[model samples]
Target chain A: MPIIVNLDVMLARRKTASKDLAAAIGITAQNLSILKTGRARAIRFSTLAAICRELNCQPGDLLEYVSGPEPEAAEGGE
Target chain B: MDKIQRLSSRLRVLFLAGMVSVPVLHAVGWAFFERIMATPPLNFSSIFGLSWGEPPFMAGPATLAMKLLGFCSSMLPGAAAMYGFACLAGLFGRFGKGEMFSAATVRLLRRLGWAVLVAQGMQVLHGSLASLILTMGNPPGRHVVTIGLDSATLAETVTGVVIILASWVMDEARKLKEEQELVI
Candidate 1:
């Protein structure tokens, strides 16, 4: 996706580990990893807000729009 | 949830019944299937219970082969119909359980459609062959090779095609459901 997640960068800049940020944001570390790695399909407003509040960062700082080709679809076969 | 649970339970029972009914029906058919395909289509003694006479059982390879062919002809349609019903029962069970947009249901529907067509095809083939065998021994100018077809065959074939098309629709619906699931 062209709309990439920059959550790992924000977490790094704030000097917070992924586990600490996920706990502070009231989300599981697994979900935080999904968000950090840009694997989430869509983010809920409440979740984004909570993450922003916990990390003391704007949504813009957590998300970035980088012009790129569409991501390939997941492979499936019989 | 209560309603869905009840429906799924009922559908599951129905599916089981369908699976069992197929063989039972075929067994019953086997008992009388050959007799029903007798030369005159039904012997008078059997109708009147006059000793329940049997069709003149064949002795030669050709006649025995014809008998075997008749049995196959009778069993194929029954098998096809049973298979088709089994698929439908499975499909209904899935629907009742709220797995409406699923690949399994679509596959079942597709199989049901194909089964119906196969049953009809087997029926037509059997009918033509059975008729030819039964009437082949007639005197000169008695062999009438009629095409194996009837109103029921036509209707069943059309219904099968419609079912196949319904399966295609289900396939599309399943794809949409998959996309929606991936949207998170």
Candidate 2:
């Protein structure tokens, strides 16, 4: 959940519509929407590669890792 | 999957028919069985298929009471069987709709488990009561009461536990499926 999809930012920068990107990447617009909204459970490497190729961006540009709050120490921790 | 759906549809019809018929059959049979089956002289041996090793302990009032009690004892568990079957029929209907991992399916399966388990318990009670009544007038030390568990009861117990376990598994699967759907 901490790994966020930044697909929308790259799509906007490239001036490419989601429908066009979906067509180019050989995926449904709905599936692309899921990826764009960060609702996808996982992205296949092949699909990620295709999206990057279509968007003229690297994988890092389409994904962002945000650190969550630190967990409390365990009861027995030193 | 299509074939499974088709078969489930057919099974749904059969189960529904059975559900409808059980109560109707019991009603008709209960209503007419006494009149149609009770012949003169009323040979208890032929009627019950038991050799008592002596004459039946039938008197005027006792015989009537015995007959009525037997009818109720037999029919009580018969009604329970109908209820159990109805739950099974409802479960089949859900399956027919292809709602395999639904809350409704889980409810029906749980109901079926309870129905079967309770019905089997009632059947055992009925058997014990019948045995007791039939041996009521036996001489001292000659009477016997049987509250034994047999193969049928064992099978029903296993079936009820399996059905309940399956329902629990389905409930877990449904939750997982919902979470997976939310992922997208």
Model 2 interface DockQ: 0.19
True contacts kept of 2: 0.19
Q: Which parts of model 1 are misplaced by more than 4 Å?
A: A8-37, A44-47, A53-55, A71-78, B33-68, B92-98, B133-145
User: Tens-digit lDDT track for model 1 on B1-184?
Assistant: 6687578768777777876776565444444544543545554321211122332223322345444554555566767777877887887777777787788989998999999999888777655555555445565566544454667779989999999999999898887776544332
All candidates' chain B TM-scores are: 0.67, 0.70
The TM-score values for the models, in the order shown, are: 0.66, 0.66
Lowest lDDT block of 10, candidate 1 chain B: B44-53
Candidate 2: segments with Cα more than 4 A from true spot: A69-78, B34-87, B125-149, B171-184
In candidate 1, the residue pairs with backbone N, CA or C atoms under 3 Å apart (3 or more residues apart, or in different chains) clash, namely none
Candidate 2 Cα deviation (angstroms), residue B57? 6.6
iRMS (Å) per candidate:
6.8, 9.5
- Candidate 1, A1-78: lDDT as tens digits: 788888888888889999988788787887778777777766778888888898888989988899889666752211
